[model samples]
Target: MSPVNPVNPANPANPGNRVGPTVHTTPKVPVASSAPGVARPRIALSTVALECPDAHELAAFYVRLLGWEVEREDTDWVKLRAPVREDGGGGTGIAFQSDDTYVPPVWPGVPGAQQMMAHLDFEVADLAAAAAYAVASGAALATHQAADDTRVLFDPAGHPFCLWAAAGAGDGADTGRG
Candidate 1:
């Protein structure tokens, strides 16, 4: 059996050639102009806000660690500006908000909580110097890894942060291993 077009039997090439004219219709859509009236979100370049028992104390620790200067300060809020290095890459800005009656979180042995909610990880050219600076800036070394030699430190408000030696400077080979 051969297939045949029921619409047109005269032209074999035109399978559906019965139509004298074809119509193409476009769906209607509401268009809005991208003008001054259009609403747009005011986005920030970068923001990292933290809750601490004392905003001033926490802000001071970060300022010393990252060499950041205070951009804004008040009784309840403090913001630090992360200075840009000679390289293109920039540092992070930290904001601290006061939290009254805040209890420090205990990791590992704490019931129902095995880890911290968030932690700041830093790569330093001189790990020893960084650790010393952190200590001088009111940070306590909480945990240390003998195998990898990385250390986890906490600020006065018990916010966990880490200091690790940067790679590619006689630290170790890029051993594809964690």
Candidate 2:
């Protein structure tokens, strides 16, 4: 028995093992809403998971910005839930997982650096006010902004998010699209 190099999965020590992305043959379709005759959708998105060096710290940052309460947490993970709406319905949550190898991603991406896979968006009544609030809440304004109506801010983990104002919020542009 001998160790195998993952970069070279095929070796004398190990054979017939492949390591790479898997391809899906079937076409993906959107899930239909629970209409009168439509069957209930089997899948529902509960949370967006984030990886950071400190789950608790990242979660705390979101808690201040979104007014979400900590729902569940352990040594390596923390979950925060949005405040229950007036209608008494629950809200989607964000989960953070602490990874020892976590590296802050670069925004306005560089040639070969790690780029953020995704980012969060918050709709605000006033773009300038929103940016100020986020800055006061431990978030830094990003130097590279993509649009006039949308201000970009970076969280402690270096994830870039947008504070977007609607069409009539002074920019006169449609902020409906993400």
Candidate 3:
């Protein structure tokens, strides 16, 4: 039998002459099937983006803290690449996008005003040393510290994050795997 468009039954090369089920040649975003015994697709978190008044300023703060390099930047957006792992794979990225309406979150969360939407945590060999470095790099140590080995500080844009003393590092004490 001679199909309407024999070359391609679903979608004929001639757009004006359409035929068949209108074959969708579009590519998907790549999801894994849920069939049994099948290896699921590995979903990795690539970046954690933060909204700030100044993307470049916030990115600079993280760059100094993590010793990461600015992979990309613009007036309104910035991307900082984490230090490469010893295995040679790229670490997760951190991005900052400028938001003029950005309001610094209040730690412990306030009722009406801005509350912390998210925060990052870091493990350090020495809590005191790390906190000092952060302060020197324009971070302010929060007064509401609740842990002996964990210090909470606000970045230049007022995002609160924690720096914990790693287990068996500073005082040879297990601070619950900071």
* Maximum-TM-score candidate: 3
Candidate 2 weakest ten by summed lDDT:
14-23
Candidate of highest lDDT: 3
Of candidate 3, the 10-residue stretch with the lowest lDDT total is: 14-23
Give lDDT tens digits, candidate 3, residues 1-178: 2235543354344242221112346543555576578776888888899999999989989988989988888889999988777998887899999999999998755468796767787878887888899999999998887567678899999998888776676654346622
After superposition, which runs of candidate 1 have C-alpha atoms over 4 Å from their true positions?
Answer: 1-45, 87-89, 113-115, 144-149, 170-177
lDDT of 2: 0.76
Clashes in model 2: which pairs? none
User: If both were scored by lDDT, which would come out higher, candidate 2 or candidate 3?
Assistant: 3
lDDT of 2 by residue, 1-178 (tens): 3456453344433232211112345535555567778687588789999999999999999998888889999999999987787999977789999999988878766658986677887778777877888999999998777666778789998887888886577645455532
Rank by lDDT (best first): 3, 2, 1
lDDT of 2 at 36: 75
Cα TM-score of candidate 1: 0.64
For model 1, the local distance difference test gives: 0.67
Question: In model 3, how large is the Cα lDDT of residue 2?
Answer: 25
List TM-scores for all candidates, in order: 0.64, 0.71, 0.73
lDDT score of residue 166 within candidate 2: 65
Provide the overall lDDT of each model, using Cα atoms, as 2-decimal numbers: 0.67, 0.76, 0.77
